[model samples]
Target chain A: MTTLLTDPATTGAHRADTTHPSVSPADAVRQTMTMAWRATLKMRRNGEQFFDVTIQPILFTAMFAFIFGGAIAGDVGSYLPLMIPGILAQTTLTACMATGVQLREDMDKGVFDRFKSLPIARIAPLAGPMVADLLRYGIAATLTFLMGLLMGYRPGGGVLGVIAGAVLAMIAGWSLAWVFAWVGTIGRSAQGVQGISMMIMFPLTFLSNAFVPVETLPGWLAAFVQVNPVSHVVSAIRDLANTGTLTAEVGWALAACAIVVAIFAPLSVAAFRRRM
Target chain B: MYAVTTSPTPPTTSAVRTEGLVKAFGGRRAVDGIDLEVFPGEIFGVLGPNGAGKTTVLRMLATLLAIDEGRAEIFGVDVRERPHVVRQLIGLTGQYASVDENLTATENLVLFGRLQGLRRADARGTAARLLDRFGLGDAASRPISQFSGGMRRRLDLAASLITRPPLIFLDEPTTGLDPRTRGQMWDTIRELVDDGATVLLTTQYLDEADQLADRIAVIDAGRKVAEGTPDELKSSVGDSSLHLLLADPTQLAAAAETVRRQLGGEPVLTPERGRITVPLERADRAADVLTALRTAGISLSSMSVQKPSLDEVFLALTGHDTHSETQETAA
Candidate 1:
């Protein structure tokens, strides 16, 4: 306490107006990767965070296929192609939803306060967990396909188609996670984010051609199913995984994913900045 | 001027300067119209009760919270204008331990370094040195959730020092520690100043400010009541006083008489019939009062020797206690 006045090094140590610059684009990317590394570390410590991507994928795939196959398609074998891709889309959405809920929980922790006090890019903390979440989406997509294979369902698209379908679905899932991330930023609590996510997700997944085809619905219902981004994605997955065709549906799915990212990415960043 | 890439130029004599700083939550201003100036290389203390807005002031200066309706500058750079540059100049240890609970102590420190642009190997080296310095070497690999409160606080402080900015903000840095750990924390804070970092700390304990601060600002209800050396603040309030409770309410007058005989000033009576507060010139005078009360046939229930409470200090300095209904503004 006494030495502070005598010591010039400790007190008034500011030098020539350095005015260190804010983070650059390159530094923003680097900082995001570091935040991603932190998310992976958190995942390792709390393995339960993976439950939705793992157990839910297998459970929903098997339960939906066995129960709806015979009645909707006239035979379980015939239902495989349609059901598998739909399950893939559904499970991926579930995985993406967890991204927002977990983000809400993570933000409430004391460490996030420290992150705010640092000079890192504002979007790093929000996007880092989404980047690490690519694995969760991958797991959910693969398990849905594997479970289909074990149930004696074969895709005409074969190995290339399945891999391509999985990759496309994962990309869609990652982009769509921005919606949940935005919710996480705006929602008051983790449970609140989950509730709003479920409200949004259940309708998108259920009202689409995920479990049932579009033709079976009323005219107005079918029209909505035609435009619901989830249907485009499912149709795209079906083309890639069931027929090995990269058709217009695939393009539509990619365009939808791009638009979601373009809109919701900025929304998430803006809300996150306000929180800090 | 914004493009000039120098170190914000050595702050103009003041390490920290804030004018009319305010932070509002909805309708209430947590910190309202407060001004502060802290010289470089000094340990300046903000002394106040729990709601005195000490942390709010620190957070605004540290750039952790927005400064509403006022100007805050670190060195000479305006906080509102260049928060990033201000962040580069200051380190803040929040009241709660802000280290990651999911990470090991070493990993937490390294992660903080990496976030600040340190290379991996350099971060690891710094982590090892800090872990050893804070006496957490043995538990460096242990998860933070397993650490004791004192250990967690130490690790939190270590994380803040990883970059070692020239100015530090410590918000109630030792609120809940055993006496021994508290003493060690005070020593560590002194060491930081000796190494040449200007520190602005907020504390509820007057003794902590007396021990660590070169100057003190007494705050209450988001306002600075007094600013001076510790001796000046203590002198205005007399000194640390004595609080004694009698075993029998009937003995209160006799104990009061004994206190008056042993110490010159009239003892203050409390609402409680058996308790009285005796201000002291020196702490040793407490022993004289205690001995006189016992010899005067006054039985004691409990006794404490301490600095005037926030209430006591407020009464002495502003002629009013802190409770809202008891407030006598005109007086």
Candidate 2:
């Protein structure tokens, strides 16, 4: 040990050579994928993280279909078409809330400090877990449709249309997740992010046409629901799942998603950079 | 004490160099203008109390925080302009254990290795080797939440070495560990330096700096107050003193006079107890003073050499106890 300390050549041999090239764009993508894998492993190890997407979808889909079916649509079968798409949109959006809550939790625990010191891309930590969350959204969407099928609702759009509807809902969920990610970066604690996300989510999902037709809402309440982006998403899913047709509503929903990513992606990255 | 001065040109072998580096929060400077230089394969210790800007300066050098003023360079790369490049040349184990508690020990190390640009198979291989080296092989698959503080700290240190960067920053690496664990951490640091990695370590424990640092800079209130080798700093406090407690209280005055004559200085006499202290001009003079006291018929109950402690050095330099202030400034 004494000789090792005194001999500069032997000791310096372990020093990393700085002449190696800088990280390439391809390496950034790989690092992001590694982070995504970590997020997926965490979700798998902790079964509780799955409760929202799995059990909540089954329980809410049945509860909403049974309690409101008769009064709103005359029968459970008739309401499934409307209710399935609504529940799908609602559950997927709720699942995205976890992205912000978990991000805040991870940040508070100081893991990001290590990430900031690494040569990886700045967006890897922010975007990687979000990529993994696409799976959670998919699970919730699938369960909601499965529950709809068990309630005697048959879709005229068939399997392909149902698959399309699920895909569109997941894309919307992914895009909306950026908003929560931004909140995660700015929030002080995980609980704070959870509270703020819940407050925003309840109003966005409940006030929209997810539960009932906007026409049935009171005039003053309908005004807000008409402009809610969630309502357009639900309408787009319904058009694809119930009628097997892609309409202007789908285009509107996609445009809303694109706009959200455009605005919040840069904002989330900026806020994250400032804090680090 | 070395005066604080800016170097016109840092040496080519320097692993790290900083000039007038400053970081402020809410209009108050957390790190006042500071200058430092650390050479390759050297263990440079930044000794200061909590909130003395030790961690803040390290953070800027590691590219974890933006430098508000002046310049910081790592291996000749400007940290602010090319942080990614700087990052590639260094690894940091922060003041806190920054590993993911939700992930197992192996998982955490592998994740770090992968992020450091190791191939998948190579990452796994490195994780296994590090786990074994750190004596954490048996608990490799267990989540960090179940590990003790020492285990978590070891894992944290292991994660930083995944890339074996030429320079490493350790921020209070043993702040909350038991004495035995701190000893282990010291050995690990020594091994890292022996392997040719230049280390810049910030610590509040004076003994830690004395044991590990090749050179130490004593900082207080965001400014460096002293910089020197440990022995140099100790000697600056003057030669060791010879303290004597006489068995016969009536012989105190005689013993004081005898010590003064032998040491050629005024001896401090305590009246409450028969105690006399005299500075020894040289350590060999201790034998002469003891024999002179015995010949004078002043029997002694206890007599020992009291070398100046780092605590006294810190007190003399900063005018405050080392552990008095607990509140730290934001970085």
DockQ, all candidates in order: 0.34, 0.40
lDDT of 2 by residue, A1-276 (tens): 001113334323222232233556777788889999999999988998889999988999889988999999998888899889999989988898999999888877667889999878888898899989999999998988888888787988899889989999999999999989999999988999999999989998999999898889999999999878888899999999998899999999999899999998889889888887
Where is the poorest 10-residue window by lDDT in model 1 chain A? A1-10
- What candidate 1 gets wrong by more than 4 Å, as runs, is A1-16, B1-4, B7-13, B241-306, B320-331
Let me know the TM-score candidate 1 reaches against the reference structure. 0.88
Give the DockQ of candidate 1. Answer: 0.34
**Would you estimate the TM-scores of all the predictions?**
0.88, 0.89
**How high is the TM-score of chain B in model 1?**
0.81
True contacts kept of each: 0.50, 0.43
Query: What docking class should model 2 receive?
Result: acceptable
Write model 1 residue lDDT over B1-331, tens digit each, in one string: 2334553443455788889988887776778888899988889999987777888888788766777788987787788988887776777788888888999999999888888778888888989999999999999999999999899889988988887767888888899999999999999999988887889999988889989999999887777889999988888887787888888887777778889999988999774668899877899888888888878888888999887666777788777766642121110
What's the lDDT for residue B227 in model 2? 89
